[model samples]
Target: MLGVEAQKSPKGKWTMPPFDPRFPNQNQIHNCYQNFLDYHRCVKAMSRCGQSSQLCEYYFRVYRLLCPLSWVQRWNQQIQDGPFAGKI
Candidate 1:
């Protein structure tokens, strides 16, 4: 099952989402952001670069990109409400 409702986005935690289950870190928030970027790149490349996608892949890209944006919106509320406000 999708773990959204049951799992908070680490907004109030000492850590953050996308936390590495392997090696430990006190600041997993940064890592989560990094991973989000990496995955975005992969999705872009796969959908727009080497290969092209049909309607399904297009939908997939939209859904995937929204994940990080959701995280940013949820965790870094100030960032969204600050400089880059209303741009994305």
Candidate 2:
């Protein structure tokens, strides 16, 4: 059962985000943007509540996997420069 177990284990597998019913169409742009916002929102909320930010990593990983590197870079820069237009 080693092969079966390996398949079940997520150790070495890379994958796209699972299909989100909220963004059912072929285009994943909205999904990617939403995940990025969610990550920041989650981190912000966690900090406000005195919770650990580590719990927000799920959205971080999802956005990083789904968004283009260039877009991510631009967003990070916008955030750092205090001009990010996103709600998060």
Candidate 3:
């Protein structure tokens, strides 16, 4: 079931990404990028600590919700090609 963060449009499309206290500004570009980085960082940290990657789902969900598909694809390609500038 969708949480309170989920809103339905008049056409019945489900909207995503509840408000995040950490990124309160109108533009969500930074928030999206941060969540993507956070998801990778969380995965890396969890793997290093021998913990479950499932714990990072929140970050994954947020990024997936906010980021455009092309941007994500490009970022992923950058990651694979070793050109990603993010610390993670």
lDDT of 3: 0.78
Work out the TM-score per prediction: 0.34, 0.79, 0.79
List, residue by residue over 5-87, the lDDT tens digit for candidate 2. 32132334348776679999988899999998998888889889999877877776677677887897788788888989998
* lDDT at 66, model 2: 78
Query: Candidate 3, 22: how far from true, in Å?
Result: 2.3
Put down candidate 3 lDDT per residue, 9-85, tens digits, no spaces.
12323367788998898899999999989988988898999998777777777887788878987887888889889
Model 3 TM-score, 2 decimals = 0.79
- Per-prediction backbone clash count: 0, 0, 0
Q: Over 4 Å off in model 3, which ranges?
A: 1-14
* Each model's lDDT: 0.42, 0.76, 0.78
- In model 2, state the lDDT of residue 56: 73
Off by over 4 Å in 1: 1-23, 50-71, 74-88
Q: Give the per-residue Cα lDDT of candidate 1 at 66.
A: 37
Residues 1-88, candidate 1, lDDT per residue (tens digit)?
A: 1234422432233322343554276644545454544544454566666664232332233334334556644534544356533221
Kindly give the stretch of ten consecutive residues in candidate 2 with the minimal lDDT sum.
Answer: 1-10
- Model 3 lDDT-worst window of ten: 1-10
